[model samples]
Target: MRIYKVGGAVRDRLLGIPVTDIDWVVVGATTEEMLAKGFRPVGADFPVFLHPKSGEEYALARTERKSGRGYGGFTFHASPEVTLEEDLIRRDLTINAMAEDDQQNLIDPYHGQRDLEARLLRHVSPAFAEDPLRVLRVARFAARYAALGFTVAPETLELMRQLSESGELEALTPERSWKEISRALMEDQPQVFIEVLRACGALKVLMPEVDALFGVPQPPAHHPEIDTGAHTLSVLEQAALHKQPLTVRWACLLHDLGKGLTPEEEWPRHIAHEFKGLKLIKAVNERFKAPRDCQELAMLVGEYHTHGHRALELKPSTLLELLQSFDVYRRPQRFEEFIAACEMDARGREGLEERSYPQADYLRGASTAARTVAVQPLLEKGFKGPELGEAIKRERLKALKAYKEQV
Candidate 1:
């Protein structure tokens, strides 16, 4: 049997980037023969083995046939007779289809190296349309390599558009869809992911709430970008630029959903949009089965991002209430993330990308001051039960009032 290193490891290696994962394809190997060696069986549907020493995955060279619908509708055939070229042709992108031998000889039956040099993401074959997941995968690759000036080939994008219109993306489970989306959000250019999805019509199919924002108008004075959709993407861009975590990035993406619901008669004004956006955020969270941290932070950012922007002007009582709403004393990290998302929104407008966001520091300082209020002092005064809780709140508010005065 001959084994060749395949997929992302080979691609990243060619690009002079650090290779984090390594997969193998073994030609002229049978399941019984693999078992006779030290490899351990791991695959549920096909013949895949884990190396006893390195624990890396190794699968027999195989070919696939589309048997049903969605990403999981494939039937596989793996045997000693399957060729490496056959296995390579079935991959989604040409750059990912190349392999390397033990001697470090590059195998490029599908011109993956040529496409890589061209800075293009091209499909390996017309068979690329069989799996709907490739649409997301290609967009994710676009997001990942956009810094390197790589773009999807026009013909490949046409296929993606066709797949989007075929009703196949609807069959994707929320778990699978979210897996791509969350990964894409954490990429260096997260907004490119959204742009690619919108270009291919997948955003309209999977996330109509976000897609509807494209043509929606916003006050040009506050949002020089004018288009609400453009503003949302700008927020995502700022979140990525700051190296924010996934929860913060997710919050940035959903913070302006209510703006899409504004009446055209009202034109650029969207009064009370913060209150109108909470239900939309909850719906998106439930639809994608986002983690509780992501769900809660997104809702908080949606319902009160305006408060964050107005931190300097709010009354001391309102400031204390906002801090209490975020539970700053208990979940300080989440409060910090909320502040970051709000700052991203404030800075996301056109020509405002470099503007200062003093509100973040103000809110953070307020949280620190309130958290420093001693509960032990209340206990010493004989406060207890519900009365103690109320007393502690009063002292925290008093501390915030003093902080407001000094700052």
Candidate 2:
């Protein structure tokens, strides 16, 4: 049996980009033959195996017939008749459809090489429509390859539009959809994903809430450049510029999503836009199948919009109070999550507001407290168990009362 390196690794290798995953396709290997040859068999429903020594994946030369919808609903055949070409034909984009044999000779049954050279992404075959998840994949690829000057083939875009309008994308589990979106969010120019989805008419299919951000007008005094959509894109660009983690970046993108739902009555009434923003974050996460921690990050951005800087400024007594306000002791990691997201949130909106958010001023005052007791470790202070508990409670309450009096 002949083994061929396939998909993204080949594409990345050709592009002189660093590749992380190595996928291989084999011709003339049956499932039993693979197992007999010391490959640790996995994927019973489909035909995939792990190479014993190399630990790299070596999938059987298999073919698929579309049966249902989304990504999972398919019937695969790994018989002697299946050719390597048949496997690549079902791939979403031509760049990902190329393969390389053991001799390191690249295979290009489809003109994936031509498309990659041309900076284009087209489906391998008409079978692309069998799985709607390809639309999101293509959208992500558009963002990643945008610097390559790649464009989606017009036919592929048309097919995506048809699938979206027909709601074939709706069959996708929220988890699966977010898996693609989360990866897309990590891209350098992720706004392209949103734009591509909008072009394909799939944004409304998955994210109707934030999709409304488009064309939503902003007042002339603060934002004369463009609508909320434009502003969000700018914010996303800025967030990307910071080289922050995906969670922080996502909060920046969604922090202003609530503005679209607010009435533009001259001054822009987003008094509790933070509150609305938090709910939308949860909704978006649920709709897109985000993890609990991710959902919490989004919620914390909205819920703790006011108190980030306040934590830094308080007297040790007052600092305890502010920490208590967030109920931090029981949820340390989550509270820290809120702090990180709030920093991103403020940074995203700071320029547009062009004025100090409440937290900014509070943070300025907080530096003094940091100078004093910042190094005092509570664990080393001879406090343990419920005694540790009572001391903390006493200090926190005193801080809260003192902080309120100062305000």
Candidate 3:
């Protein structure tokens, strides 16, 4: 059997990127033969094994047939007769379809190298439309290579649009959808992911809450971009620029959903959009089965991001209440993440990206000062039960009042 290094490792190597993992495709190999050679079976859907020494994944060269609808409705055929070319043609993107032999000979039956040089993300074949997941995958690749000047081929984008309109995207499981989305959010240009999805209409299907924001108007004075959707994308871009974590990035993306739900008469104003956005954020979190930390942070940001923007204007009691709401003393990291998300929101407006966000430092300092209020001191004064809680609140408020005065 001849083994060829395939997929991302080969693609990234051609792009002069540091390859993180290597996947191999074995031509002219049977499952029995792979097992006899000491490879451990690990694939759940098809014939895949792990090298006994390196533990890298080795999948048999295979061809797939679309048996029905959605991504899972496929039958894979793997045998000694399956050619390397046949396996390569089944990949989603041409750049990912190339392979390399042990002698380092490049195999480009699909001209993946040519597409790579052109900085284009093109489909391997017309068969690309058979899997709905490819739409998300292509968008993710767009996000990854956006810095490298890559653009999705027009034909491939048309195919993606067709797939989006085919009702197939609705068939994707929450786990699978989130897998692609979470990965895209970590990419360097995650805003492009949303743009691509919106272009293909998948955002309307998978995340209508976000889709609804596109045409929604906002006060031009606060948001020079004017379009709420444009503002959201700007926020995501800011989060990326700041190198914020996934939780913060996600919060920035969904922070303005309530703007879309405002009455037309409200026009440029969304007075209580923060309160209105909580349900939409929760729905998105539940639909994606997002991690608890991500969901929790998103919810907090949705409900109180305005409070963060107005940190200096809030009364000392209100500031203390906001700190207590976030449980800043016990969960300081999450509080930090919330501040980062709020900073992204404040900076997302057109022409405001480089503007200072003193609210973040102010709130952080407030949390720190409030956290220093000693419960032991209050208890030593013979405060007990309800009295102890009241005394601690009084001291924390007093400290915040003094802190506010200093600011």
The local distance difference test score of each candidate is: 0.94, 0.74, 0.94
User: What tens-digit string does per-residue lDDT give for candidate 1 at 1-407?
Assistant: 99999999999999999999999999999999998999999968889999989999999999999998998899999999999999999999999999999999999999999999999999999999989999999999999999999999999999999999999998888899899999999999999999999999999998888998999989888989999999999999999999999999999999999987888998789998888888888989999999999999999999999999999998888998998899988999999999999999999999999999999999999999999999998999999999999999899889989999999
lDDT of 3 at 200: 88
TM-score of 3: 0.98
Per-residue C-alpha lDDT of model 2 across residues 1-407, encoded as one tens digit per residue:
87889999999999999999998888887888988989998867878899999999988887888788777889888876778888888788889999987787888988999999888889888888889899999999998988889889899999899889877898998888888998998888888888889899999888876688887776555566447776666666655665657776676667666776687673344566666666677788778767766666666665654557445454566555545554554565555545555554444442553434565444333332322332236667888888877765665455455544665
Error of 2 at 143 (Å): 2.0
Q: How well is each residue in 275-374 modelled by candidate 3, as lDDT tens digits?
A: 9999999999999999999999999999999999999999999999999989988999999999999999999989999999999899999999999998
For lDDT, candidate 1 versus 2, the one ahead is 1
Which pairs, if any, clash in model 3?
Answer: none
